[model samples]
Target chain A: MKKYFLPSLKLTLVTIILCSICYPLLIALIAKLAPGRGDGEKVMVNGKVVGYANVGQRFSDDKYFWGRPSAVDYNSAGSGGSNKGPSNADYLKTVADRIDSFLVHNPQVKKEEIPAELVTASGSGLDPHISPKSARVQIKRIAAIRKLNEDQLVTLVQQYTEKPLLGLLGPEKINVLKLNIALDNLK
Target chain B: MNTEMIGIIATFLITLILAFPLGKYIAKVFKGERTVTDFLLPFERLIYRFCGIDPNKEMNWKQHIIALLSINMIWFVYALFVLLFQGNLPLNPDGNPNMTPDLAFNTDISFLVNCNLQHYSGETGATYLSQMIVITFLQFVTAATGIAAVVVLFRAFAGKTTEKLGNFFVYFTQTLTRILIPLAIVIATLLAFNGTPNSFAGKDSLVTVQGDSVQVSRGPAAAMIAIKHLGTNGGGWYGANSCHPLENPNYFTNMLEMFAQVVLPIALVFAMGFFIQRRKLAYVIFGVMTLGMLTFMIPNIISETAGNPAIANMHIADAAAMEGKEVRLGVTASAYWQVVTTIISTGSINSMHDSAMPMSGAMMLLGMMTNCFYGGVGVGILNYFVFLIIAVFISGLMVGRTPEFMGRKIEAREMKIASLIALLHPFIILAGTALSSYILVHFPDAGWAVKPSAWLNNPGSHGFSEMLYEYTSSAANNGSGFEGLSDNNIFWNVSTGFVLILGRYLPIIGPVAIAGLQASKKYIPEAGGTLKTDTATFGIMTYAVIMIVAALAFFPALTLGPLAEFFNLK
Candidate 1:
């Protein structure tokens, strides 16, 4: 066994080390070069940063759009799906409850306008955006609360909406925080 | 009747048929007889010179196993340190204060063992940079170790007694260098190009939605996605798994990722056939594996197309509306990816099995339960070899003649070794599952027991499925979960980790040793009485023995889980 070629062993090991080092360095370089945009300087209200509008948070009010169910009491570290099945009675019940609660809050809104993602939590609870359709459905309630026209609210949702990547990666979505912050800024 | 089921069967059959000719081509390409390795020989030599390692010193099977084991052990220790000291590391997004000792220990073992039962979302929670280091790099090595083992087994099939078994370190290095690294680089680039986030600079900008602000979390996603598929390692960077927009990004990337997951394992059967000089054998094995995948997947897609009665009752558009899945992949593509990844031993999931129809979920569980017949990187080929050996043995018995496999006489010693090799994995998986179930039953309030009774949740059949799924995931080393089970704590982590290691190595060591023993023995010539292993009759027998053994070993547990859940539904 020891009589085999020494050069082969040396070459194999060196190539491996080089390859191993290459991946991390390349990733770092790409990350540095791309430097994907941040949620942008945090928004502040009354001197304290309220929150970035890029992640999901609970909006318990009857008139607000309800996001999906959370697994971790809204604990960011606990972001996860309920891991419940479609046939799960508990899961079904929660969906019904969310829909019912939404209806109660905005009695005039039709069911079809509600986006499934709005009522169903994205697999990760930290889904910062809701489908544009979901945002559109809740426009009337938000407009009623803030004394803005529903059309004006729909226009705002359209402005904040993001298209899927290269026009096909995901559904069009509107960030909840940005929309809510804009609502607050409305005279 | 529905497109989802039609899509699944079509995909499974296509992948199955494709695997064969592909396996044959690969077999020819890698057959040591081919010029690829020879052409790459200079590169291998160049690498050796740079590392200052002697290529002349060839290790036997035992020596190779030792080197592989040593690498694994060292990584385990290294991983432990990373987990222990994670709080001091950087890149912790949620500023997760720190992992508690018990949690850290559980996670440490989980990642190192390659069970990687990730129930926590890393960005939102506190995992030290060190923990991430442990989870990612060690995981790469752990996966590579299995691939290395398969490479060794491939050598055994292709070798004569006089030929070297190949160097463990060399195989290990080549696999990481030639295969994993390049693959990761390309896939990551492609994924990033498709808009899967690959930055650690943080949030990609808060956007407004429906009069509210939301924070869209961002990170170095492309790097992780690359390894996730390459390693058959499936811990999602975030808790949403591949379903997350950032992780999977788009359908084109989604298609690429699914292909990335299966290409290695499919290529490996050809690797085996090429090395063994019997390209036909690889085809047969590939055929059987494809058939097994189709059997489970076709039925699943069909049943799922009928839609859940409960969902249908609720007037939800039950006709293939994959509610829990990303609309980009849809039900068809998601189901296809799910079955392909699970059946091929890649655990990256695009669909939620728990939310998939019960029968679909059962198929996923069964896919894992079969130990990824296309198994792990190297383990899959080794497993097929084991099946091949058994095929020869049983046929030899039927013919009242001694068994001969790949030119080696299979006598009592070889058979005993084969039996031990064959039985150890199932023993660990089924035994551990049984004990866990018993403990759950006896102490219904145990911390691990998420739902003790079978009445609620998915109840009865589905509830049992949750248990079965957990065991299947852990024991098979297929990391996708039943998800519904509350296996988040120490007991499961430690216990499942034990099974994971045993499930991976015992079968590995057993098969390799048998190969070594067989290599040393003399080959018996074929006689009129010689049992023919290549026939379809023997193939059916081989399949029966394997399935029977698996069924008999876990029937009781199956009864308790899926069957029990089935009855409870009634």
Candidate 2:
């Protein structure tokens, strides 16, 4: 044990240098060539940074599209989900409340028409994307408030909606921040 | 098939296809055969000389264990201090404060053991320097430690009564240079390309087009995330783990991370087969493991996809469970990740386990409880080998003959070690739970950092499951959590901290000791009457043994936690 001590210590130090210092530096260097230069990809408008492409931002107004319910209220400083168990009365109540609020906002839509992602707090609590169905469901409220053509808003959503890889994986979804940004661009 | 299922199938199939060649490469690496990675030899030699370790110097099993544990001890202490003083340290991009002593203890031990059970959110809990040095650094070494230790087990099978189980430093260094580092570069590059942050920049403040300002936390996350999965060390750069968009990015990277975490564990099984010159036996073991994974995995997929019954009863349109799940991942991928991460003990999650349906939670618990179905890196095979030993002994008893594994007699000493190691897992988990339960019920207001009454995230049976999940995860050295549990309090931090150490080191010691003992015994020649341990029959026997052992130890606790919730929901 005594014999191994010096070697083990020396080896651990070298390993830390290699793994933590050298390796991360190398990856960070290579990341320089990547999109956003390894800093988060920012969605820019009029040369002004408007949230990260990946990190979700909360939008509570009726004039714009909103993302999924946020457990952390879309606080990007830290992230998390509601972590509510399916059988927990409190969590179910939270869901019920989300449903009630969604109904009040989009009274033209039936309660059953509410997409689950719209009401459920996403795992990251900062889910940037909502299913295309979720985006469409909000057309009536946004159109009524912004006085925009409903069809025009619908096409704008389709434009921002990201298709699944090869249309064979994942769900078709729109980044709420991007969609809302584009909505602001409409005359 | 639906596109969601397509994603799941592609991810898994790609992993299986890739595991074959990777396994062969790993086998060659440890066996000292010439390979593509031989270019790394000169660099490895430099490390050995600098560390004053003779790469050719072979150590007995006892020395190997000592060397492994000693370094791990150094790392544990070093990391604890770093976390406690991270606020004063450089790389304070976000200017994160120091961790409480108890939380530091839990975090250090958790990462040191490859458990990575984070009590604090990564964004605020650790500075960038600590993230790289402690979390990312420990992630690599701890995984390499497991791979290094299991190489001794390989020699035990292939050797003819020898104590030269190869040099621990050589295997350890070689694993990093040849496998983990190389793969990390590729994976990290791809992740960076797909929107994971890579800059040293601190949190970037952005004004949403809608006039709301937000702090977008950024750091050197791509590299940490790569090895975090590759090492099966699932500590997250963000509080939300892989569920964080920057951590996972998209479906492609999600599949990439999932595939990355399982690859080595699967490869090592084949490496063992290649090392021991028994491909058929490896298949038998692989078969039982896959069967076990699918058993729990399918139920989780069904439950998660069927959605929460409680939510369905709310008359909502969707029946699929999406709470604490991302829309991009949908249900199938999230469900697959829930089972795969726990079963492999990688513990990376794309969704929250806390919000899973009662049945899904039970299955996740079962995955960790049976922790050997394609477990963590090299540790998985080591664990499966212990079950193999038990199966061999039981069958030998049934046949009224002396038991033998790889022509080595299974004596009382070896059996004692194996049985105790097997028992230790459940012992620590159950004992820890009982203690926590006692504290919560008897001393709700114990003068701890956080009172026991407030420890749990949910009420009633679900809360009980939270306590049970923490212990089970610690006992299995699985770091994934029911994150809803407001842990980081002294009670949880201290209790689970102890469980993490005992759970990790004891299991490694047990397997290495058993392998060493088995190697030293005389190699008896094969005979007509010797039990054919590599056949399908033995696989069934081993499967039965695993089921009985896991069910017997954990069923009542499951009943009290997930099962009660399950039936009540019905």
Candidate 3:
């Protein structure tokens, strides 16, 4: 026991330095070459930093494109989901309420056109992307509020839409932060 | 197939293809044959010299157990103290407070056992220094520990009757240098470029385009996230784990993380085949495991993609299962990850398990309950080997002949150890759940940090499932939780802490002991009377043994929790 314990402790001590210290240090050094300088990539508008390119934002205004309902309200520092079970009565009522409110805000948009992603809270509560269908469904409301052409808004959503890997894998998603930023800039 | 389905299928196929070569490479490394990774010998020698370890010194199974347990003991003690006082430690820019003794006990044991069942949120509960030194450090060594433990079994099988299994330190260090470190660097590099933060920066405050103020947490996440998957240790940098955009970033990264966790477990199976000079045996084992995985995976995918029935009642358009899921990966990809993570025991979730459909929950439970369908790291194959022993023994009983495996007869002692290990899993899981349930019903106001009444996040049957899931995760060492369960209290922490130790060590000890005993037995060459353990019939028998054991032990408990919820889903 003594023979094994001594060596085991020594080896673990050395291993800690190698793994916990040197490994992450090496990775951090190489990460200097990555975007955002490894401090998280920032989304800048002109000369001012608005937010992170990957982190979602709260967009409750009727004039802008909104992402999915975030359980954490897009507080990136404390990210999490609703964690409400599928069979929970209160959770189902919350989903129903989200649907009704969407119809109230966008009376022109029929209930059948509302994508589920828009009504439901994302797992991370910081989902930057929305389904392309989610983006398309909100075009009319955004056009009416911003006084922009509906076809122009649809084209913007199309242009901002990100395709699946090799166009044959994953779902087609549009980055809502990028889309809404473009909306504010569009004539 | 739909694009999401294509995503799921392609991920699985690509992993299997890559695992073949990786398996052969791993076997070569363990056998001390020359390979591309030989360049790492100098570094390995340095680690050996510094630790005063003679890599050539071999040990019997007993010494190997002593060495493994002692090292884990050192880790648990050191990690517990550090976690208990992490607030006072340096690099805590986020100012997360120190953990109570109970939560620290649970957290330390969880990561030490390679479970990574985080009772506390990673972003809020842990500091940067603790994350690097304790959590990420445990991820590396614990995974290497598993690889080393399995290699002892490999060396046992490679030789005739003998006691010289292998040097534990040699296998441990070489695995770290030759396999885990190189693979981790590649995965970490890919993640760093793909938007996962890879620096020492603290949380940053920013205003959105919509003029909303938000504080975004940033850290040395890319490095930790890489090994978190590479080692099949699924504790995430953030509370949401891989679901967070910065942690997983995108679909390609999702596929990469999924592939990273699975490839090693599959490769280890092939490695066992190569080490034993029986590739066909490996194929049979692989076939059985893949089939077992698909049985759970298919139901999970169908249920998750079908959308939740409760939301379907809302008469809303687009009734896809989007709650607690991301749009980028969609439900199909999320469901695929759910099965892969649980079945493999990686437990890094991209979708919230608490909100998944009832059928999906049942499949996840079965995945953990079986716990051997392409399991965690090297331990996965070890668990399957136990099941194979039971199958061999049962079949021998059926035919009135002695059961033989690899060249040795399956005697009573080996059978006893295997049976105990198998029973231990269900016993710990069910007993822990039962205790929690009893507390909730009888002593809801019992004075703990968090009362029993506040333990559940969802009510009725789903809530019962949460208690069941917590224990199952701990006992299986799978680590992914229902998330909604408010389990950061003394009762949960203490109860699951003991469960984590027994779940991890006993099964490991049982397998190692059996392998050692088998190795020391007189080797008998193949004969006509011996039941051919490598045939397709044996695979079916082994699969039957696994399903029967899991179903028999867990079906009633599962019926009460997930099945009840499913039938009552509006």
Error of 2 at B295 (Å): 0.5
B469-559 in candidate 1: lDDT tens per residue? Answer: 7667776777787676666655666677677777667777877877777766666655766666656676677777767766776667666
Chain A only: TM-score per candidate: 0.72, 0.96, 0.98
Q: Residue B36 in model 3: shift from native, Å?
A: 0.9
Candidate order by decreasing DockQ = 3, 2, 1
User: How much is the lDDT of residue B205 in candidate 3?
Assistant: 89
Task: Report lDDT per candidate.
Answer: 0.62, 0.91, 0.91
lDDT of 3 by residue, B1-570 (tens): 789888989999999999999999999999999999888889788888888899888899999999999899999999999999999999999899999898999999999999999989878999999999999999999999999999988888888999999899899888888899899999999999999998888899888888888899989998899999988889999999999999988999999999999999999999999988988999999999999999999999889988887777777776798889988878998999999999988899999999999999999999999999989998888899899999999999999988888899889999999999999999999999999999999999988778899988899999999999999998889999999999888888889999999989988888999999999999999888989888999999999999999999999999999999999987
Q: Which whole-number lDDT from 0 to 100 does residue B46 have in model 3?
A: 82
Candidate number with the higher DockQ (1 or 3): 3
Judge candidate 3 at residue B546 and give its lDDT.
100
Which prediction has the highest DockQ against the true structure? 3
lDDT (Cα, 0-100) at B153 in candidate 3: 85
**Could you tell me the TM-score of chain A in candidate 2?**
0.96
- What does candidate 3 score in Cα RMSD to the true structure? 0.9
